[model samples]
Target chain A: MSNKAKHWEKTKGQMIITMILWFFFGYVIFMFGENINSASFLGYPLAYYMCAQGSIIAFVVILFWSAGRQEKIDEEFGFTEKEDD
Target chain B: MFKGKFIDNLPKIYGTYTGGFLVFIILMAIAESAGMTKETIGILFVAFTVCIYAFIGWLSRTVQVDAYYVAGRQVPTVFNGMATAADWMSGASFVAMAGGIYFGGYTYMAFLVGWTGGYILVSSLLAPYLRKFGCYTVPDFIGTRYGGNFARFCAVCVLTLASFTYVTAQINATGTIAARALQIPFELGVWVGLISILLCSMLGGMRAVTWTQVAQYIVLIIAYLIPIFWISNKGGYGLFPHLMLGEEVARLGELEAQFGLVKNSAAAVKEAGVPGGLKSISLPHSEVPAGGMAAWKFISLALCMMVGTASLPHILMRYFTTPSVKAARKSVCWSLFFIALLYTSAPMLATLSKLSLMDPTLPTGIIGKEISAVMAIDWVSAWTAQKQAFIADFNGDGILQLNEWFMRGDVVVLSTPEIAGLPYVISGLVAAGGMAAAMSTADGLILAIANALSHDIYFKIIDPKADVRKRLIVARSLLVVIGAFGAYIASMRITGILGAVAWAFDFAMSGLFFPLVLGVWWKRATRQGAIAGMITGLGSGTAYLIYVYPKFMGNPAWLGIDHLRFGIIGASVCLIVMVVVSLMTPAPDSATQKMIDEVRIPSGKTILGKQH
Candidate 1:
């Protein structure tokens, strides 16, 4: 593939990730009104616990993970610039 | 001669923090002497809170000017999250939210939804682009992006509207919390918060705010969580379940037996007209399921929280400090995580306290049928020496009846430790955390306000030829002036502290958030459209707030709408005007287009894959 094509693929990937996050966000809101705890794992109310606690934890985790990934992607695509500019 | 030069300047720069610490120590001593448990423990917690503040000061001093302003554009994602948590969790989040949850139930759940979820929108849509541009303030982005001075002025108007009123309220909250927790006059609390804010904010800008906020986040979360855990352990319930049901049931049963429900099955109180049994309005319910509003209240509140989180200036400014678009995006996620720890716990605290109210076991337990009001009281007095303060035996009745909880709704979080009989050490920590939350946000706002005035207004507009050094001096002077103004307004008790902060969020969402969001994400957004939207948002939001504020606050009606729901109305109008106006105006110039393209490229690289 040409370099232009590679850039296209990277841009496509970023868009896809952004869309996926938006979808998950919508899903969380739809489930918000329900009893979060009743959707349980190991007899714990999973949704209840998550809405109350877990969602925030997941949010934090994803932020760091995605940030690291984006930086790597930028570097791989030769998007990195030196400060001398 | 060397000592004289050093000594003369040192007092202005360093003693602010030192003076802040000395004052904090004195405040702690007073709290200990007045009502703090085991004086040594109370003093120890005060020492801990002060130590955290001192460490933040040390960190700020070590970083360079760029770092001091924007964390050297190198802060890691998680650490930034902690700092953002500190930034966002103002007095409103740390103090009033718990009580809101405690009192309002499902209706209040909107707070968590709006606040936590807004980060997703910010990280995905805005933070990366803002960071890529490398601007100092939000206005910088608008001015450079649009190539106009007018845009900068518009930005300043919106920022000032959002922050000035909001900061004053934070000061009010800090004053109230300090006075209540430390046993000082309310004015003293305001002064303490103000001085601390001046110390950190004036010395270093966003960089100082970041480290201090990080420290505050730790103090706040520790202060918030420890009390909840302590309460849960003693009360014998998991955090959420007890809060939801336990206390509610206990209080209900106590109320029922006191009113002679068993003796006369179909009876109402003789004069008060309240029903005798389970349907009593005279007592506090576990939840206000339909707290006197329709479904619209719920929807509007949800909208407010959702939009408000994205709109705050202090929170928005954090994006500028990151090294790249990616870092900013990650920081939002980190922020959500830090916020989640406490935000999630708040409702649970409310639920547990409610459940404890309904628990029909001991002091707050069920009343026997034979125990008329009088005998029930004697039994409670004998059974539990004097721990049950919420119970009152009115009408000379023997039974322990539900009176007011002696705590106002605002005091719910602050009083939780004492209510659960936790050590004074923890209460002191919570007090410090509340102050930190208030001060950090206030300092950030003051910095933003001062920056807009000195850099954007005076230096940029009034004195266009002023040097960078002069502009910096002007910024420092403005910080002191604006900081003092916020403190003075806070002392006046303008409104409920939390409500005022929330109001600022509302204003920002309507006037600022839409313009910025559309400007960054959509190519079609034009200057004319942006200006029109800002006018509609700022105009109606201010008008609605001023007009209907009285009615919403339980004053006489003006057009009959509640103040709480007024924000959504403003936001809706703003969005409508923006869309309509954008369709009519011409697209941005090629220069503006080029600027956009530049920001769109990832940091540390050219989009064309060549060295610049």
Candidate 2:
């Protein structure tokens, strides 16, 4: 594959993984918000606690982590945007 | 403080500004304790904040073409993130989000998820590529990618309509804040807000907007957090409420029971709602498969918002100011991180703030109590005087029930401090923050519409040889014209700010999302195919919006998509038509194909050349 396509290949691979994690934290858990309510932690239902804080925090981490992976992909395929001196 | 380079001196300038703001808060609090009138404190809060924004706008004022449109393409990532966060936190997120979560329960989180989830798509799919494409507007992207003026014009029309719908809503929020803060009429307050909004953007354009948004974010976050901190501490949940509010979620339920606010599903709402009776609390008109629990009713609203967030022209425009493609990508992470600061706290505020109102032991807790007694309370009487809240006793039992009470969601965040009986200064600070939220968003939306019209429609299309000074003149003029028009529409009260915002998101995504995404990813996407897809998508979405509207036929939703979720169908049809049409037509020229590859690579200098 050409360098451009290789960069895209690695980026796409990471993107698929990121999307799954994003979906799981954002949707799948929230969809089952009630069924998981009985499993209480910290004096709150699991679902409520998760929705209130955990998932949002998860989103932040996922964003940064995805950026880090993209940097690696960019470097591996020689696609890094060089800062002008 | 260093004066040679503003960018290098950013910390010094903003640090002093922040310190000065803290001192101002201290003075406001002291003045409140020293027996200052509430109205004086409120006006001072607003005047001080707006003056600060206007000062920044004046300081950044420029006639330079690049700076006017894209902040000279030199904003730092973190500052851009804060600005984007402020831009994202409109009247909806600042004021209505907690209320949405408060009233709708778990299902309302779809918005929180969808909005935040959208940045992931932005970071990976759009922002970096758009930054690499080096365009000033979304329509510029459409025009270049699709290779035609007609496609760009269609994109421009939908952008203006959707963004105008959005701008009017923000102005409505500003009017609400100004009306309460200044004791002026709502319509009059709208004109006041419009002038301040225009002052922030008209002078320096996006450069002014960028710095002003950063300042606004600071004021808003402080205002948002202080009340939550006070409520949590007062309620024994501690300062870090989300971490320790273990049973407080359950406390909300206990409080709900005590207030007799019970309803299992949308079916209950139907029985409880009086025909043509005044009801402003937003209950979803439809249900989802989350057990028909009503909490899950608007799950699709979240899904559409995600796609909509990715497509919004104003939001996409923010990335262009970043220093590099990578910076633009990381800025999405920062945007969500800053946004998360407020969003994660919204549910906490939702439960705790409701508890402040519902806990019968609390002095302001009025539900399930006698109507006359509740009326006598100062905050209750005050909000009721402004027509933001209502209480009626229907059962002749002398006690208030859930059915006899109503409150506008827009007022909940503003009124929470008063309801919780905090210092009047905190309420003033919140009023300042609310205005900041509204004005900050209005600035961005106005600039987006004005820039697209001035840059793409005026400069590029109508007069390609237009100079930098002429373009700036046209842009600023459009800002004033549009701002006044928006204020007029806002005074009419077309719908609640949140409802208008939802429609804006639906319209934005309906027409723009598939074309934008496919433009970058699929080089086969032809100009004709894209133009056809945009028109059909937007047209179908508008048709669905009308069909479901109560004043119209009120048709039942097809495939369970309501008016707010019409993007789901619009985008689906757009993708299918785009794919089918692209294959049936000839490919774009090699130049356009190569331009696609250049954006995808994300390295080296931008494909488009420097500004004149």
In terms of DockQ, which candidate is strongest? 2
TM-score of each: 0.78, 0.95
Report the number of the highest-TM-score candidate: 2
Clashes of each: 42, 1
Top candidate, metric lDDT:
2
lDDT of 1 by residue, B39-128 (tens): 454445544564566556555653243554465576656667777888778888887887776555455555666677677667756778
Off by over 4 Å in 2: B258-298
DockQ of each: 0.30, 0.53
Residues B1-612, candidate 2: write the lDDT tens digits. Answer: 477878877778778888899999999999988999999999999999999999999988998988998998889899999999999899788988888776766667677777787887788779999999889989999998998789999999989988998999999989989988998999999999999998899899999999999999999999899899898887677768878776667776665555554443445445554322134323321112246333344356666887899999999999999989999999999999999999988888877766666666776677668888888888878767766677755566988776566666655688787777788899999999989999999999999999999988998789999877788899999999999999999999888777789888889888999999999988899998898889988888888888886667789887667777878877877788878888889999999998898888878878777783
Overall lDDT per candidate, in order of appearance: 0.63, 0.83
- True lDDT of residue B585, candidate 1: 85
